[model samples]
Target chain A: MMDSPPGVADLLGVLAYAELTAFLRFAEDATRHAPSLTDRAALGGLAAAEYAHFQLLRDRISSLGVDPEEAMTPFAGPLDEWHAQTAPGDWLETLMKAYVGTGIALDFYREAATRVDDETRDLVEEVLADEGRSQFAVERVSVAIKEDPRQSGRLALWARRLVGEALSQGQHVALARPELATLLVPAGDDITRMFARLTEAHGRRMAALGLPSRP
Target chain B: MMDSPPGVADLLGVLAYAELTAFLRFAEDATRHAPSLTDRAALGGLAAAEYAHFQLLRDRISSLGVDPEEAMTPFAGPLDEWHAQTAPGDWLETLMKAYVGTGIALDFYREAATRVDDETRDLVEEVLADEGRSQFAVERVSVAIKEDPRQSGRLALWARRLVGEALSQGQHVALARPELATLLVPAGDDITRMFARLTEAHGRRMAALGLPSRP
Candidate 1:
């Protein structure tokens, strides 16, 4: 055993917990918004994908000789608080949150995966792969906003709040787990530069959703 | 092209919705009761399995040229009501609900799978195949009851109530969709006999959990 890296377990644990929580949140939103059985099934399918990702990360953590629970426990507070602070008010808001929030998180994971061991990096890249289900959210949200242009302002505000809260939690996690942060940014890399890239990507996703880039 | 069978869509719809709701309910229970990270991860994996089953059925429904939403509409009321009526109160109750409820639902789907076409039947059998995740429930519940034998009486009562409500919903489903019932039982096959077999299996499962068979 090469002693695993300083933040391998922590990163895996955080990602695993994130997927599990995303599964629950998506399941909840499906129940709340699935206007038809088809929509519900689609949302259910998306949630299942999240759970599958959670399993992969969890197994990877276990294989590293760390208790998956112990690994995930440290990140639960920040993740749960992020969800609490950014809870969606309705169906469209839920979709926006899932789309914007997932996009940013996956981007962060992709960036962080570059700094870890090949095995861990491969696992992270695999989990970060998009399943195209978010297309459903994008199409639906775009159509809904187009139909009622007035709703755009409110949804835009909601998306901004989601991004703000997510970034706050990301910073909180980075501060609480210095080793994990170091793994994410590496020894010579700039955390501030990485944050800028994440934010720029977030803005592009917002533009795709027809929402304004700034909060 | 031979038109789809009278009840094939209905049957697929019912199973599809059942899996979706089961996914949601399981996700909810996992959030509520998982005492440890491992337990929570186990529940998440189980929920993922249900969602996988949901996708299989939903895709089948689409292949038959019927809109999956319209196909799933008729059974939503009964399934939702069954869940509402049997909502779990705590961690133990949540585990009991997941174990007993999922066991019975799978049994019903298994029996009904017999009456459908080979392709559909195969899908049903595939989904019904146990991934051994329920073992997590059985072990936990059995150990808990063994530790505090006095709690057995109340938990047993809860199990009976679950069965009763499930049966009631089963009856409601049968009455509302005669085509579905006809497909489930076929000619000369006794529905009562099917119910007996289901209950017999349910009893065996209860016994496996150290609960009295009579309950």
Candidate 2:
């Protein structure tokens, strides 16, 4: 057997938890926040896609003969911790999280899947497609914000906190799931460089989305 | 311009409500009721599929130049009233709702679709196929009920109540949405026959699922 890197399952487990939580959050936010019919329907459609992704992950986990919910539980705490610690304060904050957070994660998964076998790679592709829709929706919402710069400032601050908390939690996950970390660690000199690369990618995303990059 | 039955939209609207409520309830119930990992994954999978069907209804309504959510609001009360009155008391009751309640609804859609043009007929088939997994899941859960006679009785009683409330609410829908009633009446002596036919179909389904059929 090819010696696989550590933390692949942990990575996927965390991804699965993300999908489930995103579904609940997306629905709750729409039902509680968005003021228009068009926004609500678009959000509902996005929420539906999240649920479908959750199902796909569950199916993949089940096919492994391990109950998905069990494989899912171990990663819930750190994942939930990350989200709570970085909870988006307003509707704009929430929208940014949906865009920036899921976007980077999709990029990470795309990069990581190349190291995996074909079957899991296919699963990664399926999830990435779902993530792409969510990213598109958040971009649309951001454009809806372009007429007001004040709204953009609040979201920019929220994005800063999100990235900060995400970095902290990502480290926690690396510590907690050594194998997943090992899988991602390039045959490298320093973990710091890997973190820097990720941050570099994040800055580019903010520039593209018309949000300012934080120091 | 092609002429069409008024109830076609009504029928689809009811289905939209069913999918929405089913997803919401299953999300709550599976998260709350099921103690095991297997049951959670199983229930969540069905819940995800419900949202997909919900989207199809949404798309179809949009194609008709109606916002699906707005179209859905009018039918929400009657539809939700039925589900509340017919609340599944246990796990098996939940399964029966998906199997018997939805099963009969799908059958009616199929039978009625045959009278319409091919596009409408294809829509019915698409929605029914979206339901295929839930039906299979209900059967899987039924196996466990068969092993426990105690579970079987509770589920049977629940199934009876579901059918009764469904009939009551089905009538409410027809009375409330007369144009909808006319579309499915098929120039028959009375729309009462549609109700009768639906009830008979539910009865056979309950029997097939090993649940008691009568009030």
Best by the lDDT measure: 1
User: Which one is best on TM-score?
Assistant: 1
For candidate 1, write residues B1-215 as lDDT tens digits. Answer: 15656789998998888888988888887887788878877877788888888889889998998888888889899999999998888878888888898899888888877777888888988887764667788788898998999978888889888888888888888888988888888689866677788888989988888887564
Backbone clashes, each candidate: 0, 4
Looking at candidate 2 chain B, the ten consecutive residues that score lowest on lDDT are B1-10
Q: Mark the regions of model 1 whose C-alpha exceeds 4 Å error after superposition.
A: A1-3, A188-190, B1-4, B188-190
What's model 2's lDDT at B113? Answer: 77
lDDT of 2 by residue, A34-150 (tens): 555446456656766776777776776666555566667877777768766766555666567777777767777876787666767898898876655766556765676687766
Candidates' RMSD to native: 1.8, 3.9
Native contact share for candidate 1: 0.81
